[model samples]
Target: MNKAENIIVGISIGDLNGIGGEIVLKTFEDERILDFCTPVIFASIKSMSFLKTHFKSTINFHSINSINQVASGKVNVFNCWKEPVNIDFGKEDTKIGEFAIKSLASVTKALKNGDVDVLVTAPINKHNIQSEEFNFPGHTDYLAQELEGESLMFMVTDTLRVGLLTDHVPVKDISKHITSELIEKKINTVYNSLLKDFKIGRPKIAVLGINPHTGDSGVIGTEDDDVLRPTLKKIKDTGKLVYGPYAADSFFGSNNYKNFDAIIASYHDQGLIPFKTLSFGQGVNYTAGLNKVRTSPDHGTAYEIAGKGEADENSFKEALYTAIQIFKNRCDYEEITSNQLKKAPRIERKQRPN
Candidate 1:
């Protein structure tokens, strides 16, 4: 790993009563993980120590008050709060929610100040985290508001990538939310993320239909034909590589997603169900279209097996690697593009002949 590319990954311990701490500790259990990036976990050292004891982990960490004090090849825990935290493994309480927000806020501040290069957030409980401070639907929305950019809920694994056009909206409200303008906006975000973040020169994007059978020529619905079709045509006309308002039902079954670099699903369930089904324990949820790099495990707070030491860490590990890769990719893209933008030698006029 190039020293220049070695990043400081900022982690937010989400819902202390859940498996967030467990999965995070498990991911870093192998010291080899420290080879790629320096990790700075934004949580209380006391909480982490408690969890470590419970999990019987031999992993050790350094506690620091500031990001500048982080050491290379060591897991650093940023002391966000000094108060002792009581961990009730399988219980949900307002105190846990308050601590979760504190952790997230601390880490996000580090991220925005360039103290940390990328952020790999552990799973957060949406309902519990909902307070006057954090009233957003989920992490994607909160990040978008904090970073001042539109966020695409992009799910990623080795084989496929899925983006949601409408996120965290009710089923009845989904159709109203799926306007042509919204579709175009989210699709543009996905396209730009592929280019800048993922370093894809020309990404082929597949847009899924809102209704089954792609509206069946207006038999089932006209949203696919009227809204989706025209929007795709407009985007394609601009020389962007995009295709399809493909029927959602058969698109994944036919394995047609392989042909495209990314798929834009109409709604939350329409996209996430298939993605989770395909990549349950190994996928990363990437918040694309932000200037900063952020990703998280696809799974949520698994309270059922929180303290049992049975929570799988594969997804969390993948999230970390994915965040690192995206950070490197963005840096490489900017360097290459900046060099390419250098003006070529301008033709000089020969006045000697005149």
Candidate 2:
């Protein structure tokens, strides 16, 4: 809603023991990035100071005790916790996970309350960040519950976009989850997301088959033949430019995905594997179809490279840019649609036989 440069980006410092801190600090290391958006990092000054010292970073931070104190054109560090936290790089500790939760919970509330215009999350350890207070599979699932509208894990780069039908489900249970109704829901979500979020008009979408070679035409499995085929037909009949049940194996291999605006994979690995293969270090994990905007880098905690000062900040920077752009796009979309509705010509009835 705010101007592009003035938009507030609420950030969550992810797992302390991982590369979350490193990447986040590195992304904003260039002060010019502040020209695009104001960033508020939800973590204590103490924790960030520790990361700064360990990484030997020279970047300065505008430390604040609350969100209201956040100022534009500087990296604002809000103290989610006042106390210091122990940081052992590459080690997985549940205690550190609690701090990650504090950062995430506070920023999420800020996003809900409109304290922040958009959210750009750092990578959290999916395992360690699990407890009674936060028990979702990942950020997408948690955000789906907190935010309005269904959520879809839409992995994206500038040229490529891939959405998963079943993000966190196990492979064995994937088929049962991919019903006719779900196909419609996920497809519609992606379709609308393209129109509103990505500014695509008359978007073309493609769906990858659930089974190999689309069940070998019912030889390997019949779910694709029975469920996906008919559901896709119904969607296509409704005047949507949706197509496929295309063989997942060759969709990306042959660069056939470039033909469509978006691609929907039946399950997680089916889509992510190729997406990462193509844009591993540059992709963003966008939570599309939600009222509030959120995005994260394609990479994870990267415990292997934690504390090494060797992490690349491209993906995190890309996520930040994507979140801001999407927020602006959504705002523009609402305004345009609302104005069209207001300006629409009214029809008046005439009495013929009076």
Candidate 3:
């Protein structure tokens, strides 16, 4: 095929020892998904075949040597490597981490070169993925350096969306990192993401406080009152519907999160804990505010359930749907903006002057 009729979803198999294989194969096992998007898993055919059998999936893979052979309505597995590799289920190995990096790099290259429309990555063992060439804390950090635009780690489900002010940062340093500039950047990123990716108009964003109960008016800590409050106020003054400095503790418990289009958290656990509790397998970790579209399952590599059929493929499936939808939305936005520019209003001259 000269061009793909449907969007091409690039799959990067994360940690071989993790449940990445199970979830990836299980998601494609259902033939119905091929109707809208063509899935191209960036791994060897041998590895995919093994996973299909290991997970007992009935998926039939169309092995392709390159991206040009990727046809719609069938699952395609690009041969990233030909040689047989070791696969020990539930065992963490740095060697396995190397393969994860290989798959990620290959798929990311395909996305950057415009071969693939969007990327859906499986979970990786972040600790083992660190090396000389790839020292990223996670996929979001790595992608920010590789792709254009400011990246925000946006975790989303149908009803709820959470973006982090600080991701993959240590708890002790999170306070120092939540500066006015950082808070404003993350909030704007989330705001723009809701408009562009999620297709929401006039997005109302709420930001969680840095300290507990918003520092209880400087009793617990002053970062929330001093830093977060001022930054959010500054952003709100710009005519955006951004809110909060909300008490992270009671916001979700009281269901106050339902009032906003999106929520920005001070750090990782503060946002993800509530999000995962509410959505978990039903959610997708989307890297928003980027030139290229990328998403992943909200959960991490479940080493305990690696290669087991017990692993749920819901999150991975959701990630796939989210990526395809966002890609289309971005294209629509571009076309709409372009047409508006071309159809700009012109000033009419008076007939008397003529």
lDDT for 253 (candidate 2)? 86
Model 3 pairs whose backbones collide? none
For candidate 3, write residues 1-354 as lDDT tens digits.
122358899999998888998988878878888888999999899988887777778888899998999979899999888888789999989988989999999999999999998999999999988999998998999999999999999999999999999999999999989899988788878888888788898999988988888999999999987888887788889999988888999999999999999999889999999999999789999999899999999888898887667889999999999998888888877777789999999889778964
Residue ranges of candidate 3 with Cα displaced over 4 Å:
1-5, 346-354
Task: Please write out the lDDT profile of model 2 over residues 1-354, one tens digit for every residue.
Answer: 544558999999999999999999888888888887899999998899889888888778899986888899888998889877989999999999999999999999999999999999998998988898889998999999999998999999999999999999989999999999999999999999999999999999999999999999889999998999999999999999999999998899899999999999999999999999999999999999999999999999999989988999999999999998999899899899889999999989887995
Q: Evaluate residue 43 in candidate 3 and report its C-alpha lDDT on the 0 to 100 scale.
A: 88
Candidates' C-alpha lDDT? 0.89, 0.93, 0.89
Model 2 poorest ten-residue lDDT run: 1-10
Runs in model 1 with CA error above 4 Å? Answer: 1-3, 343-354
Backbone N/Cα/C clashes per model: 0, 0, 0
TM-score of each: 0.95, 0.97, 0.95
TM-score, candidate number 2: 0.97
- Candidate 2 pairs with clashing backbones: none
Q: Which candidate is the best by lDDT?
A: 2
The per-prediction CA RMSD against the true structure, in angstroms, equals 2.7, 1.7, 2.8
